[model samples]
Structures are given as structure tokens and as C-alpha cells.
Target: MTIHLAVDDSVAVLTLEHGRGNTLDTATCRELVLKLEEAADGAKAAVLTGSGDMFSAGVDLLSIDAGGAAYVREFLPALSDALLAVFGFPHPLVAAVNGHAIAGGMVLAAGCDHRVAAAGPGRVGVTELLVGVPFPLAATEILRCAYGTNPLAALMYSGATLTIDDALARGLVDEVAAPEEVLGRARELAARLGELPAEAFAHTKAQLRQPYHERIAENRASDDVHVDRMWRSAESLANVKSYVDRVLKR
Candidate 1:
């Protein structure tokens, strides 16, 4: 299954479970969007967690290697759809990040109303560079919208995975808990948020989240260019993979 869900009174817990690392595949993305919509429609608050030992490995590398151009062409809007849906959800959304959470995985966690990470070396960042891919238009603005200007540059250039503490310091993550306690902590946050006045909470949330949405909308309204597809000699996925493999190995 792409996702797993459990309901507890006013709270809904969602899990990303799609392989060894919970990488966001096309199928997984679609499943998550549908599941989150279901959760948002009924639950007072929702908490999303990753399956197994990872928050997410980011995107499915094999998918990209097999269908890079088509994937990028379609991925922007699919991602935006999911993010906007979460940002506009009627109920509070919480992310109980367990580990890694790089690239698109980072996007998933950040889109939530609240973010909590398991305390460890598990990091947060947009690590597409390490995979020889680009964040595309919507994803970039989404990151900028959440973390603002300062955090954007660090994520883009450094591309270094920030520890959970660093993630909190950078305003990328909201709370930290022990690995085993992540779900419980997220449930607690969900329960607390559920107690707030839903009307006021939603209004305030709308006010806060729209800027990012607006930014993403603006970026997507036009066509932007990138070099990820260059060197196609024509382009060979193997060539790109070699570059990524070498970079990550370093």
C-alpha cells in the first residue's frame, strides 16, 4: 500500500509506506493526495508519519531515471495540487517526520500546519541536486514561501542535510521528539490544535498559507528553464545517473 491511516476520535494518523525508504513515487503521490483529502474532510486534525525507519528518501530515483522529462513535466502540478490541498485543508495538518525527509519528502512535511521530527541525524533539505534533478517551479516557491528568503538560499546552494536541531533552528521543523515518540507527539499536537476554534484557526491558517500558494501560482504561470536536461548528447539517464552517483559518493 502506498499509505496507511488510523483514526482516533478527532485525530487521523497517516503513514507513507512505499518501499525501503518511503520515496515519493507517482503512485504514492496520488495515493497521499487522496488519503489526505479524506483525512481533511472528517478529522479535526491529521498527523502524517513515514513508514519503516525513514521519513522519505525523497523521490523515486528509478522513476526519474526512466522518465525524467515526462516526470518533471507532470510532477510540478501534481506536487502543487497536493501542497495546496494540504495548505487549504479545513482541519489542522501535522507532520511527524521520522528521518531523512529530503527533496519532495521535505516538501510534504513543510506543507503541514505543524512539523515535528524525530531527534537524530535524520535531516531535512531539498537534496535534488544529489540526485541530478531540479526542484522545478512550484516546489522552489513552496520552500521559499515557508522558510522565507534566508532559508531558501541555504537549501539551494549548501544542499547540505540539516540535522533535526538545525531544521528547527532554520524554522524548517517545528518540534522534535524521540524516535519512538514521534507519533505520540504529533497526536498531542493534533489534539491541541483540534481544541482551537475551527473557524478562527482556518481563517488564520488561510491568511498564513496563501502567500506561499500565491508565490507558487505566480511561478507556475510562466515557463522557466533549467539545465538538468542538457548534455543529452542526446541526454542519457545513465549519464545523469553517473553524475549523481559520483556527487553523492563524494
Candidate 2:
């Protein structure tokens, strides 16, 4: 029930209400795809945010443990494809992060054209390396664009957690505002976008994203190799098991 679709005039808001952390998993991804399909047609702009204090815990670490690398290789991209649909949608997409965003959540937020966060929220960054799995090609491309030629490879490799202020400084978070103002700000920006000629904005956005999407298509060829390595890596196995153990410990 976390992925609720709220529409008002030309704006559509998809919110994550899943538990405290708002961690997205396979089911959430599927639900999101369905919601987006149903809600996106008449909307001028879309805003994505999480309920409560956490944007998302990223990928479901527990799912990885339950099925091993096979789960990641086979299913994670399917979920991301849903997110990518939003990323590549003709209209503007805004990320209104109400709380923390990590790993896959970071990628989802980054996928948007503009990213805004709550000033008092926890943090946002990719921590995939800490868990021993490589980030997906789409995420890599998004981060590379956000971080530039000097991508935050080390952050991904080291699983560093960036604060809201630091995320802004690092160019990861576009703007930070009070928690209550997050959605309003996104809607405000969406209005700005709506005022512009829709065709022009859509064309410009598509032109900017084409190169990145093409690059991911190129990576698709080698993606299988990345998948195979995880399936065989002891580190990947150990990381998944550890994450699973966290749930058990609770």
C-alpha cells in the first residue's frame, strides 16, 4: 500500500508508504509500474516521494539473501525497468525525497531530471559496494551524469552515506527544503515545467537522456558478465547472508 497514486489537475504524485525505511522490492516495483501506467497519461509532471521519515532503504537486501545472485541478476533489472520508465517518461520527473535514499533508492532518485530532498532527512547515496554487488548499468549511467566524468565510483565502491548538505554539495541532491515543503516544492517546479511548451521540454529532455540510454544499451551486452561474477562471488553470498541475518536478529 506504500505506492499510492495521488493526482491533482496536471500533477501526479506516487508515494512510497511501505514501512519505516520505504525499501523498494520486486512487488513494489511491479505495483509502481501498474500505477504509473494508470496515472501518467494526463499528468503534466510527476513527483516521487516516500511516506514517513525514510525515502527508501534501496533494494530489498532480504530478497537477495533469499535467492542469491540469481535473484539479483534476473529480477533487479526488471524492477529498475519500471523506474526507468519514469526516468525516461516524456514529461518531467522530480524526486522529492522525504528521507534517506540508499543503493537502488539513490538510483531511482537520480533517475529523475531534478532531485529535491528534505533538509532534515537522513541522507542519500549509493552503497552497493558495501553489500558486494555491482550497481546496475542504468544507475551507473545516471550517477555518472550527476557526478560528471568524475563519477562517485568510490562512494559506490565504499558504500559511503552522504548527509543532505553533503549530498547537495556533491551535486547529488539538487535542493534541500523543510520536510513539509518537499512535495510543494516539487509541485512548484512541476508548474514551472508545465508553463513551458510541453513539446519543447520533452524534446530537450529526450535529447539529454538519449546518450545515457544508448550507453546502457551498450552495457547490456556486458551485463551478463557482471551478473555471472555475482553469482559466483563469495563476497556477494556473504553480504546477502549478513543482510538476511539482520531481519532474523530483529
Candidate 3:
């Protein structure tokens, strides 16, 4: 399974475990949505983390290169769906960013109600532009909701990863913890948040997120068509290949 779900008291801990980096491929994205639905049914709050030292390396670029345009047509929607599921979740969702959270991974963390990163070598940021792709509409809206337009624009434009200190300073992460304590800290936060009156908490969350949801609903169809086209274009595919060769070395 790409995601493993475990319940600790009223808190559901969802750990991403697809491949070494927990990259968000089509299958993983679909599974994330399903697991989150299940979490909503069974848990009061949730904590999302990744196995080992990588929260997620982001989208499965190698898979994209191999699958080509046909796969891009399929993957983009699934990726957006997964992001929306996390962003719109009724219960409080905490991100335990144990390691590198780049591109889509960073978006997932931003979708969470609160974020805590492991204090060490792991970096966090949005790198979609560096890979020569535009943000899917849902992703852009989610980042805008979390960081506001100006900071979101700066992060998207630069595609630069930041240290935990920088991430905390920039408000990307709410707290920092030792590598081994990241999960514990996240679970603690989740449990505390779970203690709130469920209906009230859920309602408040929905109210706060309603604006972004409306924006996503209004613009996603047309924006995604353009995003899909760009992702499938020959130029973007070439850029993906170059990124893999030079940065991923795979």
C-alpha cells in the first residue's frame, strides 16, 4: 500500500510509504484520497508523515517521463484530488514533515492545519517551476490559502528549497522537532486538537477554507485543461528529463 493508516486513540496516523521517496504517482495519489476518507470516518484528527528520512520527494517525475503525455492526462487530476482531500478534510490535519518535502510534497504539508518539520538536513519548498511546470489550480489555491498571495508567488517563482529554520520563519512549518520526535510532536498536536468539540471544529475549518474551495471550484476545470496541456507538452517533458538527469541523477 502507498499509505498505511494506524489509529492512536482518536488520532489517525497516515504514513506515506510509496517507493523510497514516497513520491506521489497516480496510484499513490488515489490511495491518499481513499485513506483520508477512511481516516475521516474513524478518527477525530490525523497526522500525515513519510517513512524514513523523506516526507516525500514530490511527484513521480520518472514515472511521468516514462508514461509521457498519456499519463500526464491521467495523473494531474488525481494529484489535485489528493491535494483537495487533504486540504478540505473536516478534522484537523497535522503534517509531520520528517524530511524533504519538495513540490507536491510541500503542497500536501501546506494543506494541513498545522505543520511540524524534523530539525535537520531535510529541506522544504515548492519546486514545480524549476521542473518547468505550472501549479495545478488546486495546488496554487491551497498555497495561496496557507501563505497568502505574495509569499506564495515568491515561493512559486523561486523554486528554492529552505532549511527547517527558514521554513519556520517563512511560516511554511509551524514547529520544529528533533528527527526522532517529529512524529510524537505531530501526534501530540493531533490529539490535542482532536479533543475539541468535533462538530464545532469541523465547521470552523470548513468556514475558513470555504473561500478557497469556491475559487478552486470556479476555476479548476479551465485552469487544469491548460495545466494538463503544459505538462504533456514536449518542452515540459524535456525539462523533466533534464531535471532527472542533473538533479535526481537517475
Candidate 4:
């Protein structure tokens, strides 16, 4: 499975494991949503981390190249569901950014309450425009919540990938831990959050996120329609194919 779940005491840890990049395809996205649901039900708080040098490279472009628009139609909604599940999770969620988190990967981290990065060369950013696609509605809401309008626009427009220190300076990540200690730090924080009164935590979190949640709900359907159209367009497919080829050649 792309998502591996483990619970110890009150903290559930979900690790993303799908090849080196942990690319989020339709199956992986569905598995992520299911794992988050399980984590919420059984654990008071959760920590999400990646298993290798890359947190996630975002959507599986290789899959897109092979499957074409039909895959995009299926993958987009699954991506939205996985992200919304994390954003609206009842318990506090901490992101242990083990490595590069690009595009949807950044969105996943932004969905969490806290984001901690491992100290090293790992980069983080929203790269949708780099891939010549628009952000899904849920991802846009998460970005708006994580960054101010100007910074958000700059990051998306530039497709800038910041190092851990730069990500911290820009508030993309809360703390930087030694590479080996990243998961530990996230778990420690999750344990602390898990200690709070469950009802109060849930209610307050709901209130704080209600606006973003509502905005996503309101725009999701329409946004998906437009995004799907873009994916199905010949220009988008050609760009995606070209991107995939470049990456493969590297």
C-alpha cells in the first residue's frame, strides 16, 4: 500500500511510501483518505511523514502520460478528497516533511496543523503552474490558509522550491529537525496536542478552519470541471508529456 499506518499510544503515524517520489496517483490518494479516516478514528492525533528522500513529488505525471485524460478525470477528485480529509481531520495533524514536497505534496503538508522539515537539501513548494495546470480548489484553499495572497501568488507563479531554512523563513514549515529526528519531533508535538480535551480541540479547530472548508466546498465542483477540461485539452497533454519525458531523461 502507498500509505502505511501505525499507532502508538495516542499518536498515529502515517507514512507515504510509493517508489522514490511517493507520487500521489488515484490509488495512492484513495489510500491516503482511507488511512486518514482510520487514523482519526483510532488515534487522538497523527503525524504524517515520508519514507524516503522525497516526501512526495506530487501527482504521478508518468501515470498521466500513460493514462491520458481519463486518468486525470479520476485522479483529480481523489486528490481533492485526500487533501480535504487531511484539512478537516478532527484531530491535530502534524506534517514531518522528510524531503522534497512539491505541488500536491505541499498541499498535503499545508493541510496539517503543524509542519516540520528535516534539515537537508529537501525542497518544498507549490509547482502546479510549473506543470502547466491549475490548482485544484482544495489545494488553492490550503495554500491561501498557509500563506498570504502575495507570497502565495509569487510562489505559484515562480514555481520556486525553497530549502528547509527558506521554507521556515517563509512560514511554510514550523520547525527544522535533524534528519533522523524529524519524525520524533512531529510525534512529540502530536502527543502534546493529543493531551488536550478532545471536544474542545475538535470544536475550536472546526471553527478556525470553517471558512477555508466552506470556500473549498463551494468552489470544488466548478473548479474540478474547469481543471478536468484543462487536463483533457491537447495542449495540457502535450505539456505534461513533455514534462514527463524531461524528468525521465534526468
Candidate 5:
């Protein structure tokens, strides 16, 4: 399984463990949705983190290059579904960003109610433009909600990865901790938030997020069409290939 769930003191910890980087692919995304659903059913709160030294390297770009346009068609929707599931999860959710969270990975972190990142070399940023893909509506909305439009616009446009300090300054993460303390800090926050009355917390969360949900609902159909088309285009595919080559060379 790409995601492993462990529950303690009514807090569910969902660890992304697909590979060295815990990259997100169609299957991984679907599994994340399922795991979050399971957490919601049984746990008062959830903490998301990644295995090894990375939160997530982001979308499985190598997989995308190999899968081609046909796969892109299937992957985009699943990605959106996964993002929505994380963003709309009723209970408290925290992110323990133990390492790098790039591109879609950063979006997932932003979707959480609160994010705590580890100190050290770990970097965070939105990099869809660098990967030659547009942000899915769900991703754009989530980041916009987390960082506001001005900062979000700058991050998206530059596709620049930021250090843990820069991330905190820009509001990408709420707290910073030592690498080893990241998960503990996240769990502490999750458990603390979980102690609140469930109904009240859920209600307040819904109210805060309601506008974004409505915005997504109204524009997703059209926005996704454009996003999917861009992702599947020959130019974008070529760009993905170049990116993969560059990374492989380094």
C-alpha cells in the first residue's frame, strides 16, 4: 500500500510510503482518498507525513512520461479527487512535513488545516508551471486559501522552491520543528484540536471553507478541461521528458 494508517489516542497517522519519495500517481492519489475516508470514519483527527526523508517529491513525473496522454487523462481527475478529499476532510488534519514537498506535494500540505515542516534541507513550493502543467482547480484553490492570492500567484509564477525558513515567512507552513520533532509537533496539534467538540469544529471548518468549495464547484468542470488538455498536450509531454532527463542527469 502507498499509504499506511496507524491510530493512537484517536489520532490517525497516515504515512505516504509508495517509494523513496512517496510520489503521487493516479493509484497513489486514489489510495490517499480511501485512507483519509477511513481516518474520518474512525479517528477524531489525522496527521499526514511521508516515509524516509521526504514528505513527497510531488506527482510521479516519470510515470507520467511513460504513461503518455492516455494516462494523463485518467490521472488528473484522480489527483483532483485526492486534493478535495484532503481539503474537505471534516475532522482536524495536520501535516508533518518531514522533508521536501514539491509541486503537488506542496499543494497537499497546503490542504491541511495546519502544517509543520522540519528544519534542514527540506524545501517546499508549487512547481506545476515548471513541470509544464497548469494547476488543477482544486490545487489552485487550496493554495490560494492557504497563502492568499498574492503570495500564491508569486509562488506559482516563479516555481521557486523555498527553504523551511522562507516557507514559514511566506505562510506556507504554520510551524517549524527539528526533523525528528516534526511529526510529534504535528500530532500534538492534531490531538489538541481533536479535543474540541467535534460538531463545533466541523461546523466552523465548513464555514471557513464554504466559499472555496463553492468556487471549485462552480468552475471545476471548465477549469479541469483546460488543465487536462494542457497536461496531455505534446509540448507539455516533451517538457516532462526534458525535466525527467535533467533530474536523471543530476
Candidate 6:
């Protein structure tokens, strides 16, 4: 399966295993939404994580470059939906960031109620500005909600990817654990959070994210067109190509 699903007691574990970096193409993005919906329906809490050396590298640039404008039109909306599903999930959700989480990956991790990063050499941050891509409306709100206005602005402007320690200090992650213990630590955190009265937790989460939801709902149509425009723009395409070239060289 492109997305692996399992249940450990009451916690649903969703592990991304599509390929190196666990990049989210249109298919994976859509699958993620379905998986989360299923988990939310059946599980008390959920843990989202990655296998091997990447939490995720973010959107699949190669896929976008290959598919062009038509694909961008399809993918951006799916991306927004996937992110909203995670950001607005009612029950306690934890991100077990095992490795690098760049751009959209960072946004996904940040959306969770609690973020736990593995100790060692993983880097995490929002680098969309560096890629010459703008955030979708829902994503912008998620970042604002996750990091507040100032820090989100700083992170985006600098396009800096930070070490686990820095990510912890910056509130990108709630805690840091040994590489071997990242998933375990996340599960522990999830279990504790799950102990809260279910209705109260769900109600409070809705209250916290309601503003973002409303904002996204208001601008989704315009945001969809704007993101598609950005994705197909010459500057953004060039930047994506350059990034792909650099990664290929390594």
C-alpha cells in the first residue's frame, strides 16, 4: 500500500511509505485524506509518521513539472483538502517526525496537536518561499495557527531548515526524542492526550481551529486559482527545476 495503516490499541498509526522522502503526489495526497477520515472514524487518537530517513520532502516537484498546469490545478485542491483534514482532525493527533520535513512536510507536522521530532540530524522548516511557491489559503492559516504570525513570517522569509534542537526551541515540535524512540514517545503523548474527555477535546479543537476553517472557507475559490497560477508561473517552475537539479546531482 502507498499508505500503511495499523492500529495499536486505540491509536491509529499512519505511515507514509510511497518512496524516498515520502513525497506527496496527487495520489498520496488524496489517499492521506481518506486514511485520516477512516482513522478518525475508528480510532481514539492517531499518529502520523514516516519510515526510514524522511518524514516527507513535501510535494512531488517532479510530478508537478511533468504534469504541468492541468496537474497543478488538480493537485493544489487535493493538497489543501489533505492538510485541512489533518489540521482540523477532532481527536488528539501527534506527528512523529522521524527525519527531514521540508515545506509542505513541515506544515503537515505542525498541523498535528503535538509534534515529536527524532533527535539527531533531521532538518525541518517551511521552504516554499525558496521554491518560489506561495502557500495555499488553508496552508497559510495552518502555519499561522501553528507558529503564530511573526515566527511564520520569519521562517518563510529566511527559508531556513533547522535541526531538531532548533525546531524544538522554535515550537515547531513539542518534544525531541532519541531516533529509536521517536514513535514510542509520540504514542505515549497521544495516549495521554486521548485521556481527555472526548467531547471536550473535540469541542476545544473545533473552537481553536474554527477561525482558520472560516478563513479558508471564505477564500478557497480564489486561493485555488492563485495557487494554480503560482505553480504554473515561470519563476516557480524555474525554481522547482533548479531544486530538482540540485537533488539529482547529489
The residue-level lDDT of candidate 4 at 50 comes to: 86
Off by over 4 Å in 6: none
The lDDT of each candidate is: 0.75, 0.77, 0.94, 0.90, 0.93, 0.88
**lDDT rank order:** 3, 5, 4, 6, 2, 1
Better of 1 and 4 by lDDT: 4
Global CA lDDT computed for model 2 = 0.77
Q: Candidate 3: worst 10 consecutive residues by lDDT?
A: 241-250
Reference-based lDDT, residue 233, model 1: 22
lDDT of 4 by residue, 1-250 (tens): 9899999998999999986788889999999999999999999999998887778888888888999988888888998999999898999899999999998899899989999899999999987788788988888888898776788999999999998999999899999999999999999999999999999999999998899989888888888899899987889999899988887547
Runs in model 1 deviating more than 4 A are: 224-240, 243-250
**Cα error, candidate 5, residue 131 (Å):** 1.8
Lowest summed lDDT over 10 consecutive residues: which window, candidate 4? 241-250
Clashing pairs in 4: none
TM-score of 1: 0.87
Please list the residue runs of candidate 5 whose C-alpha ends up more than 4 Å from where it truly belongs after superposition.
Answer: none
Q: For residues 86-113, what per-residue lDDT tens digits would candidate 1 score against the true structure? A: 5667788888998889887887887787
Count of clashes in candidate 1: 1
- Tell me, by lDDT, which candidate is best: 3
lDDT of 3 by residue, 116-230 (tens): 9999999999999999999899999999999999988888899899999999999999999999999999999999999999999999998999999999999999999999999
Count of clashes in candidate 6: 0
Kindly list the per-residue Cα lDDT of model 2 for residues 148-249, writing each as its tens digit: 755586677668888999999888889999999998999888767767788999899888888888987777658746765774477878977875686534
lDDT of 5 at 168: 92
lDDT of 6: 0.88
Position 85, candidate 5: lDDT: 96
